[model samples]
Target: MQIINARLRHQAALHSLTMVDGRFTAIQAQSGPLAPQSGQYDAQGLLACAPFIEPHIHLDAALTAGEPNWNQSGTLFEGIERWAERKPLLSEADIRRRVHETLELLIGQGVQHVRTHADISDPSLVGLKTLCALRDELKEKIHLQVVAFPQEGLLSYEGGLALMEEAIEVGADVIGGIPHFEYTRELGVASMQQVIALAVKHDKLVDVHCDETDDGQSRFLEVLAYETLKAGLGPRVTASHTTAMHSYDNAYCSKLFRLLKRADLNFIACPTESIHLQGRFDSYPKRRGVTRVKELDKAGLNVCLGQDSIFDPWYSLGNGKLLRTLDFGLHICQMMGHQDFSRALDFITDHSARTLQIADYGIAVGNPGNLILLDGEDDYSVLRRQGDVRLSVRQGQIIAQRPAAPLLTPPWLSA
Candidate 1:
């Protein structure tokens, strides 16, 4: 198969890809008078780039907003309480339907990689079971990585170890923890240690909700970095939503960056959730409940963006669209320059694949033939207009294609 006149992500000139047997065999310049091949796709100079990746999302509590009641208080605690109420009402069929629906929406937007954190704190373990099954169900179009996430805490919550072990034994790809939610700081450290040990034991990855708060005193990130570095596991560790880092003094953060860079840990920040759920307790200068994304990027550390919720208890607004995630990420992170906007797309694309550790994922000569063509000339145009995905190719086949939506026309308002 030959794909012609596709805009390159790394250059201005148009290029073509030769795909054979579900992999790109060659990428060369489109400077030929040769006749069109039998199996060829003319992109018409559209934007062609790597498939999008969703590095951090909660598939268990997705699309469950206002099940019993809404998060009226607008606090993380209230959201957790509301989710607990809805936990008992979960059934395999119910969870499967919503998750699959969300995945469809993601695929339409050109996302093919997702790392969803499913709750394992429930004694019934219904969420973990449902997501693990969904992993197998959605592998054809999307790569789903399920994390055995203890939403409450490992040490504070009862039967947490057993639940995590069960999740790992039943095919969890990662282990997750929330240290800030623990009852005490000491317990939080213990929980991080437990999660790291579990990851080592099961040979899985670690993605913890580390210090997701406004309190500057939280120091769980240091612990995670130290452990990951000591164990010689650098990129295998991910710290999601280190919001407290936003409040840290430069002195502390400067020191922290040393450990983070040495360990080469990945950072995943949710801009939508951070802007909404944080700063509720402050009065004068409300802090954004987000991490230092630009700083991390400048430090040469891997940083990715995420849509933490999609019409869920924690956040009421989400479309599961990675473009929206990138929009908020650029706005909240204050990365609005020309180069900033161009690289901001990586927050959901290349940088995210690194966070999830997706192998051979990009528009390369020898990479898999999983790519998307959107309606734009460059990353800036595609992101500013939120262009439609013209084509979605998976494994050397066109799985989905969408045309440009028609502009509304009336007799009086016709253009």
Candidate 2:
């Protein structure tokens, strides 16, 4: 199949792409007759980018807003309590229904790769079992990665460590823990060590919910960095929601950055949830509750953005759109400069693929022909307007395409 009049990111001229047998065969600036074969597409000068990747999300609690009750205080702990009250009621049937719906929604939004944290602390393990089945069911449309996350606490929750081990054996792709939720700081650090050891023993990946509070004293990220260095597990480990770093003083953060770089750890920030769940304690000049995205990117570290919640107990908003997620991140993180727009978009696309360790991503020849066509002229326009993904192709097959909504130019407004 030949696709014509497509704009490759970072390149000015319109180009044509050729796909053969589920792989990109040719990519060059359109300079020839630009002939089309029997099954061809004309992008109409729209921006063409690699398929989007979601580095972190919680599939278990998705679309469960107000299940038992709403989060009145809009606090992180309240949300956790709500989820705890609701976990026992969870069944494979409900999880299957909601998860499948959510996956379809994401696929339509051009997300072809996703890493979702499914809570493994459930005594019944129904959520874990449901997600594993969904992962296999959605294998062709989207790549689903599951993390056996102990949301309650690794040490505080009864038999948490054992359940996590069983989850990994039962086909969870990653090992995850919520160390900050433990009973003590010592327990938190110890839990991270256990999480890393489990990852190494099972030969899986590690992504911990580390230091998600606004307390500057929260220094578990340093502990995770140390563990990463000691275990020689560099980029395989990710620290999600290090919101506490926003409050860390320059001296301490500088030292932390040095260690994080040496350890080569990845970071994922959920900007929407960070701002909503954090900063509740401050009276004035409250913090933004996000991580050091700019500093991390400048240091050549792999940083990505995630839609941490979606109509769930924690957050009551989000529509499975990566463009909006990136925009929210750029706004709160104050990364709106012209030079930062392209880089911010990469937080969900190229940068996220790196964090998810997707080896076969990108638009280069010989790579799988998975890409999206947007209603955008170029990268800047796409980022500025939060352009919609009009067409999504996976493995050289067109999977989703939505026509542009009608322009509602009312007479009064236009006049």
TM-score of each: 0.96, 0.97
Which numbered prediction scores highest in TM-score against the true structure? 2
Q: Across residues 53-159, which tens digit of lDDT does each residue of candidate 1 receive?
A: 88999988889999988999878878999999999899999898889888888888888899999998788788888898889976887899999899988888888
lDDT of candidates 1 onward, in order: 0.88, 0.89
lDDT of the structure predicted as candidate 1: 0.88
lDDT tens digits, residues 333-393, model 2?
A: 8887989975556888988888888998999999998999977876678877776799999
In candidate 2, stretches whose alpha carbon ends up further than 4 angstroms from where it belongs are 32-37, 413-415
